[model samples]
Target: MPMRTRDSSGRRLATLAVCCAIVVLVLAAVAMPVAGHAYLSDSDPANGDRLEALPETVTLEFSGDGVQVADVTVTGPDGEDVSGDAVIDPDDDRLVSVSLERDDTDADGIYTVDWEILAEDGHTTAGSFFFSVGDEPVDRESVLEAYADDEDDVSIATTAAKGALLLAVVALVGVPVTAAVAVYPVVGRFGVAPSVVDRRLTRVLAGAGVVLFGAVLALGVARSASIGSSGLSLEAIRTFAATPLGHVWLVQLLVAALVATGLLAGVRGSLDRRYWLGSSLAGAVVVQATVSWTSHSATLVDRLQGVTVDFAHVAGAGLWLGGLCVLAAVLPTVLADAEAGDRDRLAADAIRRYSIVALTGVTLALLTGLILAVWHAPTLAHLAETTYGTALSAKVLLVVAALGLGGFTRFVLLRRLDPDRERSALERRVRGRGSSGRGSDGRVRENGGREAGDDPTVDETASTTSTLVTRVLSLEVALLVLVVVLSGLLTSTPTAVVAEQTDAGDPVTLEREYDDGIVELTVGSPSVWGEHGSAFVDEGEPVVFDVTFTSASDGDPLESDRPVTILAHNERADTQLQFDLEATEEPGTYSTVQTLPDPLWWELRVSGSPEGTYVSEWVDVYAVPDGHEHVHEYAPLEETGFTHLLRIGAIVVGITGSLAVAVETVRFGRRQR
Candidate 1:
């Protein structure tokens, strides 16, 4: 093959390899969630069953085999967790019982329990039910739905507040922090001097620091409003300080204060050099910690591992993005300041240092991003199906675009602007600017100054490279900002479905005897039709319910004169979902496939006229919360220290990598010049 063709082949192979790697990551990530059929066979108080009082233990009986219960949260009349530690039946796992903690609530009004289960066969399912006390009629589905409503899921103010906080972090911390810790040091080694860097860099960092501190406060206030029962109120704000979210808020406030103090001390140029650097980096690491702890990682995946990977992701992004901002904002001014012999060397060092930051950033972002995606989205279909998955997909695409742009600049544009070419560009720029070249102190030199005798072409080359860097870095910053914004959305956006589609289990069997031992209902093993099944219904997806009614005396199928239909009532809205059933070839069996409209407890009312009297009987059905938003409502089970090690390792690796790049780039610049 020709040289050009061989190069083309190499590029093709590289691209193919990257594409293949992504496919593998996506495939491997499908975190097969624990799954199995776990439907309600019986409840202690019985759904919609009026009771004079409630039992101490809320017992849930499931007919399915090997059912393990989780997320068994109970809300009483006052909307507090009444369900305490839930335990599965020791002998028969099908019976899950939760002890009630009713210090604040008696057997009054309505009590709702939202529970999920994992089966021995590897299928996970979830549902909710409502129980009434003291003769108050519980509109089964309505009361349960209303009891579990999430105000934050649809709140625009919440989304906007989170987005603002994210943008503020990137601007105030990402850019300025990276500049102070990563960018300025490299330029200073070309004799830019610590004093000069402090003078020029402190103003930006100070302004950004103040903005970040303010943003942290604003984020806290917004969080209180979003998580409160009422939207944007003083009481909500006050109560927020007591929640787990409030705990995160307090941590963030401390980190913000530390960052502000470090920026102030660094800009003063009065602190010990090591102390200044150590304090600033420490503050930055804490910022990443606060972010990781409050982020989706803390709730969505394995807590410690998620936090560690996310910390690396945030740290890398902060440095890389921060460096880009510094370049874009400071480079144009730096290029116009002086036409010196070492100007090209200075530009080269800065570019190489930033390249290293970008390399680390891209690597961290891609690696952590894959883990998060796979944890939340176990399959490709989830990318489109879940809101969180979709937002993350968008972020990944944007990051990739930015990475490609950076690659082009580093490998193509930066390579083209070698020492000779960059010097010529800088020399020409000095002539075109129309001002007498300035001295290193930024004061204008006379027309006959020392720089006036130098080759104009040398100045033009470096100046051209600076301008190119500015333009490319500007675009890169824009993309990075968008990724940050999408990240905010991903954190706030609710998952569309709570149940994981990991294990498609065998059919579920249900039998209910109603109507004075006259009518018997049998829901046979559910079979999946389309995207939904009787075992677990996906929203707006159809499920084929294989239902049959038989006479209690003979244990035979019952024939109805009036048309038989299934009514899935929306309890909140006082509406009903009707699915007309047709008689099957088998005597008493009837089948119908209908779409489940929304995620809520549906009153499954089967009505018909069998022989003489009109017959109507109902059972409660819950298809899980559409999104797994409830997982973070309370603190998760405490994790082991093993997870914390992951985060510590990432923090160490990031700082070490940054220091290595700064040292290497400074040395290389000195050598090359």
Candidate 2:
């Protein structure tokens, strides 16, 4: 081995170590308690309360800390404002209040309260409720219909910006990882040094870095435009800059600069070759970590765990899918430029090395992906019901397609590229006859004016095999790019399980303890039912149950098990049913799907044996109307017209692109077969 090759190996190890250390730091530091959107926990003169006398002041308490009231209004039956300015409590930021300006002269039937709050993390939540003060009680449905802001449309430009940023990160990080772990080492063994590939690949790295920097800037502008009451104004930008989300953007900007500058310096030959590779890799990890912070993972209850899994997930994607992209871009060019004799060895070795790296990355991505899906959806109903679920489902389908393509590549295409097999066949054919050196056809043949041991037939076979592998890898790369974009959409969209309950209605919760006092169970019924006209579930529709088991002594979640047994009795129809619940990836959470065959009144009895002791828990009754379709309806806003088009367009494009990739993959498989 040459000294330069030894040095290159040492540098690769060092680069990998630096990346691992940076990942650890990210997992620790990003857990600094970034808050999620604030939700109303309780309010004075509570929602739909029929009060004989009006109160002096109305107060609201929220679920998240550091929440500040942005706007509040109280409307009387006569359609006039009758409330003072909203004020945040000094002792508890999550508490807000506004005094009523009503008088004896005022005649009231219904009073409506509407408010919007901004959480510390910069996202806003707004809602409406009603109270009655006269002989007529509050009509909840009427109030909601008149005052609720029904626009739930996500901004198209923002999601696009996010997708672009995600793609840029994958490209920027992926090239370096692929080169270090897969390309450089194998090529160097065949006498193609890292310095040699660096000279040829510098422009590609620089281009990826520049794209990433631009993407970071685009995300900031898009985010500002998408904010409420702050459409890209300087003040709006300043306000955003003061929040935790703004801080994440700032960090993204800095890291993007680091990555672009490092790669550019290497391209310009201004940085030391020994240090640039490691520095660029370390910068890539930081970029990926910052990108994870901008996702919905930051909104999870366990912010640290969510962020960590997200980081690992994207990093693995960068390694496998991103690396495939790098290979697709570089390998063909390298093969085209290499001497014919060297091409076979180079392609074979490079593919073999990258297969292992791709395998590692794919494994990490799939495992983390499963964890994230459970955290976001929790149940099949959630996966099928929400907008977030729709995007995730689409992404999962694409991933399955990619996995099929990858499986064929690894097991079939790659195996055919075995250089040793081709060489062995050539040798046997050339040396088949004992003294005469006749070919495999049993006839003496001339070398055809070609060099000894050079067979055109074997060379043609190697070239064809290499070409097939390249085409398949290219298709796989394209598929993964779509996956990354969908991942971006997922980050911007609300979680399937959490958001479904918020918009649909509050889920009913039941709690009970086991006889041994070692286990406690908390079960949350589905949000398919609501008071007034907002109800969702109909007869014979699937209902999901979210169950959690906790240790009685410590109040911590108990170990996961198959311990839940739910029995439902329809008192009106004299029908009863029993079923079991399955555990979810979330530590102590379990979920199951069942259907209520009849409408109107039903009672539930939940039981479990978590600690070798059976515990029966009492749950509340549920009501559903018969012969009604279970459908979710979103109220549209005037401003959401273009944004809605953009969102719909994105979905259409994703579906179309995925189908095209699948068709091409299938065609390619048929050709190989």
In lDDT terms, which candidate is top?
Answer: 2
Clashes of 1: 32
Q: Where does model 1 exceed 4 Å of error?
A: 1-53, 56-129, 132-154, 164-196, 226-235, 261-278, 340-342, 421-461, 495-673
Model 2 over residues 216-288: C-alpha lDDT tens digits?
8887776565444546788767766665667877888888898789889989989866566666667768877
In order of appearance, the predictions have TM-scores of 0.57, 0.66
lDDT of each: 0.56, 0.63
For residues 256-315, could you state the per-residue lDDT of candidate 1 as single tens digits?
787777778867876654554455456556665776765544434445655665675666
For model 1, state the Cα shift of residue 80 in Å.
17
Clashing pairs in 2: none
Name the 10 consecutive residues with the lowest summed lDDT in model 2.
631-640
Measured on C-alpha atoms, candidate 2 has an lDDT of 0.63
